[model samples]
Every structure is written in C-alpha cells, then in structure tokens.
Target: MGRAHVSTHQSVGGRYRLVEITRRETNSVRWYADDLRTGRPCLVTRIGLPEEPDGAAHRAPARVLRTTESVARLCPGRIATVVDALDEDGSLWTVTAWIDGTPLGEVLAEQGTLNYVRAARIALELLDVLDAAHAEGITHGELSPGQVFVREGGPVVVTGYGLAGSTTAPRLTAPSYAAPEQARDERAGPAADLWALGALLYTMLEGRPPFRDRGRPEATLKGVDRLPLRTPVRAGPLARVVQGLLRKDPRERLTRQVVREVLTRVLSEDSGAVAEAVPSPRLRGGPALALRCADRRWSGRTTVLGTTLAVVTVTVAVLAATQSLPGTGSAADAPAASASAPGDRGASRPPAAPAPSPSGTADLPPGYRTYRAPEGFSLALPAGWQRLDTSRGADLAYRVTFGAEGDPRTLAVTYSTGVGSDAVAVWRDDVEPRLERSGDYERIGSIRSTTYQGREAADMEWYAEAGGSRVRTFGRGFLLGGGRGFSLRWTTPDAAWEDGASREALRTFLRTFRPAAG
Candidate 1:
C-alpha cells in the first residue's frame, strides 16, 4: 500500500493551520502536529534505514521535534509553526512572506544610470544595515543585483535564511559578484559584502558585470585577473571612487569610512561645481555660451524712430544748398562773395556737435602684449591676444591662443600649496622619479636665475616621448612664501614646435609674462 499521508499544523488538536506529510519508502505516512495551547510550532522528519519499516518514522519525527525545540530556545525568535518530512514523494514545499518591488538588475537595465546623489545616499544607508547584519553573524550568502529589490524607499535584500546557512542544500551561486574566498567555499565574511558592493557599482556605471561573461569559467577568471578599468570620459570623481572600490584585493579596497567620505563629497550640492572644474566630454557643449554670458550686464538698446526721417531731411538740405550754388569751375571759387548775405552767417556755422563719450574723453593704456600670472611670476603673450580666465578649482588660471589655421595652443597654470623648497622637493621626490621611470625623457639645461614679470623664477626644460611622439615640456616654478608655490608647464608636439611662427609666438608669450591678481 502507498504510504499514508500525515498532516502537520501549527496547533495540535485544533484545526490544522498548516500541514506537512511524510510518506516512507514502505508506503506509509506519518503526521506531526503543533499544539495550539502552546502557540509554538514544531518540526518533524523521517529518520531510519531505508530497509526499516515505515513505522520507525515515529522516533525520527520525535528527534526532529526535540531538536527544533532546542533550537527555538537558543535562537530566541519566532517558533517554526510547522515542519513535516515529505513522503519519500521526493518533493519539498516552503513558503514565506511575499515582498514587493522590482529587482535591482531590472531597474538598472531600464534606467541607464541612477541618480548618483541618490545612489550614494542609499549606499550609505545600506551600509548601516549591513553593519548590523554582520554583527548578528549572518553573511548574506547570495548578494547580487538580482537578489536585491529596488523599492521606492531603498533596496531590500530577500533570501531564505534557512537555505542560506544550510549545509545540505547546494550553496547559493553568484560567481561573478562573489568574493574570491566565497567562490572557493571558504568562510564568507563581511568582506564578501564589500566585494559584492564593488561589483554592483561597476555594473551600475558601465552597464555590465565587473567580472563575468558567458564563457568558460577559466577564461572569465583570466579576464577578471586582467580587468582594465578606465574612467569614462565624462565620469568625474565618481569614476575614481569606483575604481578604488573595485580593487582586486579586498584589503586594498576603500574602507567604510573612506567610502562614506567619498560618497559625501560626490553627493554634495557643490559636487557639480567641482565636476565643472574638470575637463570632461559631457560638458563640451553649451558651457562655452554660458561662460561668455556669465559676467555680461545688458541694458536695452536705444531705438531712434527718426533715423530714416533724419537721413531724408539731411539729403534734401544738402541738395538744395548745392543746387542754389553757381556752376563755376569750383563752387568754392564762387562762394567768396557771400559773406555779407543774410544766409552767410548761418551757412558758415559748424555742423551739430557729436555725441559725448560715456566715460568722458580719456586716453586708454597702450595695448602692449603681456601675460599676467598670479604673484611671483609673469610672462608676455603675443600682441593683440587676451588672457582667458577658466574658473576651475584651485588650478586657477588657463588661456588659449589660436593659430592661423584655427588650431589652439593652450596654457595652464597650477598652484600648489607648498613652499619653494617643498615645491622643488615634490618635483625631485615625486615627479622626477615618475618621469625617469617612464624612460622616454631627456633632461635639458636648467636656468637657475630667471626674471619673470620682474620676479625671480626658475625654469627647466625637458623633452619626452608621449604616445610614440616627441613632446617638448617647458616648466617654470615660482615660489610664493608661506608654503605656497605655482608652476607653469607648456607642452607642444615636436612638429608644432618646429614651426617658425609657433616658436616665435611661444617666445613672445614667455617674455611678456606678468603677475596677475590672485
């Protein structure tokens, strides 16, 4: 006979609120019940050798019930309402509270990029929850975009705890998002959550998994090992922050405090201003127009309604005066006799006075060519050119010169918050080492004493190969006291530098440098 089906419920002797049935290989069923009087749930499982009679299930179910009771006492949470060994029927069923919201992956696919500020805020909030979960000694075994729900408020992680910590059930798989240790079945810890966070950020920004693809596992592993990440052209500081988070080694990844600081900085109201300071593909359009109008003040232009009428009046008067004159060898030769005439005095009068100057008559400064840098140095630019103020961050000054063919030569000046000695030290300790390691630079002569805008300056020149092409780098450093300094660096390709006109223009610019107001 088929094993009898036994039912289990939350309350024993009361209507079976829930039911679980165990069918033995011997075709017998056993049922376990929860007594409503205690308002507690119990678990029952079938235990015995396959050859044993199905009736032996009673002992196994009792053991499971006792274990559940003990676990309940220790766990100190809601008691399991009901549990039952399934009939060797080879199927299992479980249910839990239903959750709402779309999957995070689906949401990201629909929205090209999340609101960065909002995303950062949410991440910070989630970190708080994660910290608590870690303290509870529970590692989210399956943390992935798919497992996270993007709700109206924020993300909610949904997973089965029993299945998560189970040894019998196959461990949850998230190869792409999982930490290296977690993938190897090693002890998963809080670090695994961080790894997943990195994967999540990468996926959001680049619209792809940070380290996974449809291929042989080994190939994917190799790709991950050699993953190359470049900041997207327009992605500002967020790109740098993401790169930090995605470091291959967990120890190298940003700490929670660092992450919070970065997020706070990127999400701040002034972040847009900071981002505007950086050159990026995203701001190439419209910014020029906005910049041009930034400081302009306009009042409505005056409209003269009598311009047409006035022109006609003047023409008529001139024709009449000319027509009345005698047609001699010259009108001037015949006009000497009209001094006594009544119209003579009026005719001799001068034309109406011209309009007055708005600022009154004054001699303006001669347009001499000059370059005005911040205190401590100066140079000269070619005549008839103007300095452009690029209102970026602390790297205060920038200017551009247009070539005959409409190409542009750009000059940038960066201020460093270090003294003269510190500035030289930085160059010697940091920049010089990097240049030497590049193996493409040749040191040129240095000028120990130079006069720039009437101030003392030091000049250095070097030639380097960049992108398989030779570039000339000329740098001048100025020391402003109180631990601050400024440097001007000019670079041009060898071909451009070889042009006579370009060379002369650069020389003129160097000679005309002057100090500008900070």
Candidate 2:
C-alpha cells in the first residue's frame, strides 16, 4: 500500500482554508477547499485506492456522491463545508468544522468521571446537535466518546456522514461506540446515532461502555449484544434512562423524544440529580425498586408517601391494653368493640394518620403516595418514609423511600398510556431476552394469571447485578381496564427483606392492594 499525501493552506487573515492532497497509488490528485464560513475548523476525509494498469484514479459512483451531498445539507452549521470528491485521485475526502475541545474519551480517562451536572449539560447539548442531524436524514454513523468534542461551549460531534456513503473499499475497524448494525455494514440511520449516544452517555456516567472488556472484537460484539450495563454507583436516574437507550436491539431502545425528555429532566431539574453517594442497597440489606403504572383507571397515584403509609400501617401494630375500668361518661367515652365500625373506631384509628407528609429538605428522605380509588382500595405504609415529587413525568409517577426514615432505598412508579398486546409481547420477547443474556440476573419465580383488573398479569422475582453488586427485584404486572396495564417492582438487597417479618410486610401490602372503584 502506498502512502497518501495531504496539505492545508490558510488564506491570509481569513478563517477559510484549502486542503491539497495527492494519491501516489492511483497516480491522481485533487484540491479541495473549505472556507470555514461558520468560524469553526472543518473536517476533511480522503479515501484513495491504488492505480490499475491504466493508472487512472477510481471515481466514486454518482449515487454515493449524491448521498454525501445530501448528508452535508442535512448537517449545516456543524458541517460548514463538505467536499465529497474534488477529483479522481482514487481518493474521496470530506471536511467538517474543526470543533475545539478534547475528545470526551480523553476527558474521562483523565478525570475518573465527568462532574454529574457537567456531564448532563454535555449530554443535552450533544443531543441537540444529534436531533438536528437526525432531522436531515443523516446519521453520525461513528458516534463514540472519541468522536465527541467537549469544549467550554459544550460537547459537539466531530464525525458524521463520511463513512456511510464512502465509496472506498470497506474498512474493518469502527469505533466501539458505533452501533452493532453500523459495524456490520448495515444501513446506518438516526437510530444508530441514538445508540451511539446511549453508549457515550453510559461511558460518561459509568466510566466505561455498557458492554466493554479488554477482549477481541468478536468477544466485544458478543458482550455488547448480551451484556447488561454495570450501573454506576454514582449515576442518577439519568443513568438508568441512558442504559435503557443503550439496549442492543435498536428497536427496543428509546426514541429521540424519550431521550430528550430524560435529558431535559436530568439537566434542568434538581430532582433529576442522582442521590448522594450512599452504600449499595445490597450492603444496606435492601433492594432497589423500579416501578411503573400504566392503568388510567389506577389514577397514577403510586408514591413514596403512599407506599410508606401502607408499609407503616402494616408494620406497626397498635394494641390496646384494656383493664376493665368503669367509665361514668356518655357512649362517646366508651371504647368500641369493633375495629371496622365507622364512628365506633373513629377516635381509636390513630388520629386519622397525618396524610403522609414529606420533609422537603435535600438531606431528608422524600415521601410518596399511592392511588385511592372511589371503590375503596387502600394499604398501610411504613412510617417516616419520604417522597420525591420532582422526577420527569412526576405527574405520572410517585416515589417513596424504603428502609429507615433518614437514608433508605427509593422506589418510583410512572404511568404510561396505550398499553396493548404488542407492548406486552415486546417486553416478553425482546426486553426479557436481553435481561437474561446479560448474565446479571437469577430468576426466582414468575406467575402468569389474570387479576381483578381484567387484564393478563405476571409476577416475577429476580436478582440483578450492578457493578458487582446484587439487588433482589420483585415485580408484578397486570392489565388494567381498557388497553392499559401496570408493572409494580420493588428492589432491595436481599438482606433488608431477608427476615420473615420484613418479607411478610411487603407481601401483605401486595396482597391487600385492590383496584379503585370505577
């Protein structure tokens, strides 16, 4: 193979520059120019093939050239200028703006983890750029930590559009951040870029790719396909959201809208911030719970306060030690015999329990609430549990504290609409397989049946490994009225619920739950 030549020339006092290149192999050369009209450096790519007997440089097909032009148009500001093929040197090169900043990969390597707030800001900024590129029917086929430029302004992408439409001979190496599909020479699209975004986000948070190892490409690819991410201890809700986006099945990953929503919450709101560094739930003897409710009829009222109330009521037993003493007052002074009677037990019912309040201080645990239907369904919660009301889709979600009052595990629930068979099938087929293949889980048990909600439901228990840590997950799913249904999951380290008492406390709550009246 012969070496390619490249030369850059800058016009006096002008930001624009010209790049001249020669292809010794093809015995052809081309001169490409970039004005840098947008006050940014431009990227130029050149592909050269060896000359044939006739010594003529190979020309890229018209279709490929058209595709390159289309990509350039799709990415405007970032790509101040693009030159697909100036001449036939058997070489094709494209130049995009030279964004100033260190690659994100370099930053991470230098700094163990990007500051949470800063990383979030960078993610949002990058997504904005990606959204623009995606809108133009172009994809950053090679999105990776190395391809991202982190400047004071924010993070910007460095590579896009050149690789996909290249007419040069196939290349073997691709950035690890590239989606499996793109690596396999499949059609690269917006989804591929999003997948890379997910990978990038994962790397920023966890300090590594979701599926990474010091291994060969085949092993790495297999890991990417089957491995579950090792959730970072420091990662907040944004990390989980990103992990979901990084799912191997592109179709199973989140859409651009979803990514935007999550990034928005993570960046703009204080609640999106990850909780203070705390011991793993496993070490603390509890599991981390992830919950969601999809039934409109359920009213989306599951929360920390509500669940806490139920837990408290069920966990604490109020016993009346009565010594038969004579009371001369009216019947109002008389202790009631029935605990279920309306007025009879009114005064005895723990002062109507102060409606589950949460201390708003950042240091204190938050409170949550559960749905109370008109049909009369209710449960008791543990005392002192705090609730968080500021998460994305907070209106559709409720979060509560688990374990002790001050510092404890967290449980969150969100409601979704338009649930149907397809959704269920996707979960059963696509999502489940990925989870199993990740090698981070051990199935405890699963139950499939129809509940009072009139929809098919499944109850499952499993353990998931996060950063070499294990957390037990217990979840239940049931279809609600209409096409909607819901999933309820509770996660804690096995130690927290290891005892029969704690286990029974959770089980009791689940057993007593009933659909609200229609």
C-alpha TM-score for every candidate = 0.34, 0.39
- Which candidate comes out best when scored by TM-score? 2
TM-score of predicted structure 1: 0.34
lDDT of 2: 0.42
| C-alpha lDDT of candidate 1 relative to the true structure | 0.39
lDDT of 2 by residue, 4-72 (tens): 112234231244354422111011122233555655444444334434455333333343356556644
Each model's backbone clash number: 18, 46
lDDT of each: 0.39, 0.42
What is residue 341's positional error in candidate 1, in angstroms?
99
Q: RMSDs, each prediction? A: 36.2, 28.0
Candidate 2 runs further than 4 Å off: 1-75, 83-97, 154-157, 165-173, 183-185, 213-219, 226-228, 272-518
